[model samples]
Target: MSEPWTLHPDRALPADPATRDLAREIYAATKDLPLVSMHGHVPVEWFAQDTSFGDPAQLFVVPDHYLTRMLVSQGETLPRLGVGSTADEAVETDPREIWRRFCAGWKHFRGTPTRYWLEHELVEIFGVTQRPSAETADAIYDQVAARIAEPDFRPRALLDRFRIEVIATTDPAWATLDDHAKLAADGYGERVLPTFRPDPLLHPDRPTWREDLERLAAASGVDVSSYDGYLEALRTQRERFVAAGARATDHGHLFADTTPLDDAEARRVFDAALAGTVTAAEAQAFSGHMLFQMAAMSAEDGLVMQLHPGVLRDHASAPFAAFGPDKGYDIPVVTEFTRSLRPVLDAFGHHPRFRMIAFTVDEDVYSRELAPLAGVYPALRLGAPWWFLDAPDAMRRFREAATETAGFSNMSGFVDDTRAFCSIPARHDLARRVDAGYLARLVAEHRLDLDEALDTAVDLAYRLPLAAYERR
Candidate 1:
């Protein structure tokens, strides 16, 4: 017989009875707070169209790299799991077969955050009552498919049901943002916003750099043939994003280096890159210089800057070649933020208009580097545990690591940073539980009073993200 499917009310609370009681109270105080998703990857078109999601496999499996990457690690191929190679390629056409594959590999998610989020989505969101396994897969899939077919299960309906006050979707710098404009015209602009991501145009070493530059130029109506023009084009695109209700700019670079280059040196590197004669070293230097320029732009424009560095994307070339990027090959690299960000910090760390939130896959930096920097810099706030470190234990560890130095106010509250729309509530709920448990322990230790802890819980769940992202 399959095990029963259930989510314990105190699933992530502390194990001890005294602390568990305290945690429950803390969680109850903030559990119903509206979600402020400042950073995420959900497509804006879904909200604009308000369409019903397809089958269970497409909704829960294919779009989520967190699930696909783990399944692939256990000898499952992407094509078999309904993931295509290119943008237009169709690999697995049968939803039932895809669901079967996922069910067969269900045991692999044990002790993983993906498992927790999946269970919450299945039980709480879709009202699934049966555990997922090879035997129960078809029945559960049918149940979820039936729910998805309902009008109440559509994107906008679910967003409203989830009580999401605001969500910001990651958008390419050169994107037309027509969907965003439509939503704004429809009067949902404040509810859903765009975040400008210039990763493609920042690194000239990437193969698609020239193409991305041309796209950016077209979007901005500026000629990006020279370095100055490139900067101007980027500025214009940011303004466009701001006009479309954007409040933040997202950067995902491989390193945290923020060294600035002189104008002549920057132009020289840009010219070499355009001429296809730029070396790897030159490319990295130029990228670092661009980080400084982005900070300068933020200082001028007041758009919050979000730096998510130290990820070596597409670690394996085979999967990247077979399937496009974000197939879950990104790996965390060692990062040094103290020195890497010094140049930019020196330039604009005290600027009243500039604000930056730094995210790191390198956990060592939380206490040693990030907390110290955020503690001192008025413009800097430490972003929550991101990507690989968003797990329950990792989040608790992050609090233990960073809180002593930076304190609660200096930290940006939990950011879902997910592409899975249905998983947003689950992710935020988990973060809240973890935080409540942490705060309960502090209260038990007499480090904080109960009233203060409650207030802090509310801030972490709702207020801080809005403030950090400047949503309000």
Candidate 2:
């Protein structure tokens, strides 16, 4: 007989008895604090429409790149996992088969954060008792499907159940934010907000740059034919996003370079990009210049600037061509921030209205570069371990590396940059546990008092994100 699944009460606490007790105490104190999800990729339409989730497979497997990426790595095809190339493409028709495949590959996720979150969802959220395996797949799927079909399992109900105080969804530069408007009409405006993500508009080398510019023009009612006009349109859109309750703007650039250029040069590059004659070097320079310009806008408008660079997005072209972007192929390249950001830091590092949160997939920069930069710059703050580095060990390492230089106040608390709505609480719970344990270690070593550690735990879990994102 297979062993029954259970989540230990002290799952991520320290092994040392005294420290474990301390960690448990700290975790218990902050475990139920309302979640402040300042940044994420959850679609706003679900909350606006208060839709019911379809099935276990759709909830657990279909939308999560973390799970699908690992499954694809183990030689399972995306189509077999119900991931279609396009919206119209036919994917795996049977959700039961998809669940079976996921169960068969379950062992592969052992020791992964994805496994931790999935197990938490299955056991704590859905009350699944059997460990996922090929033998238990059908029974578990039927159980989860039955639960999802109930009225209580709808998205809005889950949001309240999860105690999500606020969740900011990433939206395109040209997005109308109609769903957000609907939520406001329904009186959920403060709870669900839009975040302006203008990556497609910033990169001139993209094949769709001109098309994106036209869309921005239409959205902002400002002609983006010239470089100045492009800036005006971006500013207009940022104001619109602010009106829609956005507290920050998110950028996922190739690097953190923020050197500015003269208007003539910027205009030249902009015209070249529009005419489809811009070189790769010119595109890079223009992107860097635009980064500085974005900071300028943020300083003027008080929108917190979130800069997370270093990912080489769409690492594999085949998957990107077959499916659209964000199919989990983005790989991290080495990133530097200290020197690359000096130009912008020199300009607005002390600007009163500016607040910049820097995130990296490259952890080496945590202690060496990012920490020291955020330590001194009044405008700069270190975003919590992001993307590939938001796991148990990585979270601990981030605290160790960043705390000494930047200190706790300079750090942005956990953001749960996730597309999987069900995983939000699990992810935040993991963060709270990891932080509790980290703080417990500090107490055990006589670096901090128990009361201070408890306060820090609550800050990391709840207050820091709101302050960092300027959510008030």
Which lDDT tens digits does candidate 2 get at residues 116-183?
Answer: 99999999999999999999999999999999999998888888999999999999999998999999
TM-scores for every predicted model: 0.98, 0.98
Lowest-lDDT window of 10 residues in candidate 1?
84-93
lDDT of 1 by residue, 41-87 (tens): 99999999988888888899998899999998999888888887544
Error of 1 at 128 (Å): 0.8
Error of 2 at 458 (Å): 1.0
- Global lDDT of model 2: 0.92
What lDDT would each prediction earn against the true structure? Answer: 0.92, 0.92
Taking every candidate in turn, the Cα RMSD to the unseen true structure, in Å, is 1.7, 1.6
Error of 2 at 330 (Å): 0.9
Residue-pair clashes per candidate, as listed? 0, 0
Candidate 2: 10-residue stretch with minimal lDDT: 84-93
lDDT of 1 at 96: 93
